[model samples]
Structure formats: C-alpha cells, structure tokens
Target: MEIEYQYHFSLPRSVVWKYIKNERVLKNALPGCRSFSMVSNNIYKAEMDIHIGPIQDLFTLEIRLDEDQAPSLIELHIKGNGNMGQLNGQALLMLKENQGTTMLSCKANGQVTGALGLAGKRILDSSANKGLENFFQILEKEIKRRIYELKRRNR
Candidate 1:
C-alpha cells in the first residue's frame, strides 16, 4: 500500500527537522506510545497501539533511521510484527519553509499480512489512512507542546 500526507508546522524548518530526528520526541508524538527508547545508534524499540474498523493491535516496532542528510531530509525504516502482520515501510520526508512555518511532505509505502491482509483492500486503504492521520495529529501536537514548553523554560 501507498500512503502520503502533508502538514505544516508552527516552527522553522531547521528547528522542526532537528526536533523530529530525536527518538524521544517521536515517542511522544505517537498515540498510546508507551515507550520508545534507542537501543543503539539508529535502532529503537517502540510500542504503540493502533486500530482499524473492528481490528486493533498493539504494535512493537523496531525502527531504524537510515540515510540521514541531517536537518534537511531523512529515511525512516521500520520492521516488526504484531496482531495485524509484519509491518515495514520507508518514509521519505522532505521539509521546506512555507511562509513562516515548515511544510513536511511524506510518502509512505508498506504492506500487511495475517489478519489485516484478510480484511481486504478497502479496509487496508482506509485503515492505513486513518492510522497515519492519527499518528500525525498526535505527533504534531507533541511537537508544538514541547516547543512551547522549551520556550517557557527559557523565558
């Protein structure tokens, strides 16, 4: 399946890029993301719960951040399995300054198996879209909140 989304952040591109590259920041962005800790230089152990239609799964994601251009572009690769199936994808991210904010465009392509694959194509598409939307919403909120908190501390 192919999934894509675009969003604008209330921060500069450089600052947003730097903040997003951190595993700790990512952990906070996900909904019900209990914990995400870096196990090595580019490997992380992440746990998150996601739902689609009548199906839900607590996903344990092993993520590896590869091919970094640092504060410019990056590739996020994930590999793991859960109640749904083996989930793997590479998210290609490009950030640009839009007006005074940062605009992020991501293209995600991945697949599913097991019970989720048995659900059908329509279910897969809708589920993927909704899951990604929820993820972005939570992620964006966390980013803004953290930045706000950081500024408050500095003040």
Candidate 2:
C-alpha cells in the first residue's frame, strides 16, 4: 500500500523542524498511541491501538529515523505487528518554506500481511489517509502549544 499527504503550517520551516523531532510532540500527536519511547538515538518503540473498518488491535511498532536533513527532509523506516497483521514501510517527508509558511509533503509505501492484507485496498487507503490527517492536525496544535510555552518561559 502507498500513502501520500501534504499539509501547510502557518509557521516557518525552521520552527516546525525544531519541534518535529521532539518525543513529547510526536507522542501527543500520534492517534491512539498508548506508549512511545526511544529505544536508541534514532529508533523508537510505540504501542498503539488502531482501528480500521471493523478491525481493531494493539500494534507494536519500531520506528527508525533513517535519514535527516535538518529543516528540510526526513526519511523513516517502520515495522510493526499485531494480532491483525504485520506491516513494513518507508516514508519520506519533505518540507518547503514560502514566506513564513511551511509546506510538508509525505510519501509512504508499505506492505501488510495476514488479516490486514485481506482487508482490501480501498478500506486500507481510507483508513491510512484519515489517520495521517488526524495526526497532522494534532501535531500542529501541539507545536503551537509548545511555542506558547517557550514564549511564556522566556518572558
């Protein structure tokens, strides 16, 4: 399966980049995430409860930051398994700044096995798209909240 998404933030690319890699920000943004912890410098382990169509399961995922070009690009590799299925994927995220706004583009490709593989492409695609959208919305809010906290602290 493949997923692509684009989002615009009313903040500079540099500011977005500064907070994007924060563990707290990511943990708060990820939908249904129960636990998220770093396993190494660039690797993380996460447990999430995911629901797709009529199927729901708790997934254990290992995420690796494969490549990073600060304030511009990031590449990620992920693998996860649950009672429903297993998944493996790679994602490339690019950020472009225009004036004070930043545009984020994400492209991801993955394969699923077991029950999830039999769930059909349309269902999977819809669920993935919705999930990504929700994640980004929450992320933007979290970033803004953090920025507010920073300003308060500096005052």
Candidate 1 lands at a TM-score of 0.88
lDDT of each: 0.79, 0.92
Q: State TM-scores per candidate.
A: 0.88, 0.97
lDDT by residue for model 2 (105-131), tens: 999999999898888999999999999
Instruction: Encode model 1's per-residue lDDT on 1-155: one tens digit a residue.
Output: 78888877778887787767677778878777878999998788998776766878888988887746766677889886787777778888888887878888889888777886777878888877776677667777877887889999999
Clashes by residue pair, model 1: none
Which regions of candidate 1 fall more than 4 Å away from where they truly are? none
Per-candidate clash tally? 0, 0
TM-score, model 2 to reference? 0.97
Give the runs in model 2 whose Cα sits over 4 Å from its true position: none
- Name the top TM-score candidate: 2
Backbone clash pairs for candidate 2 read none
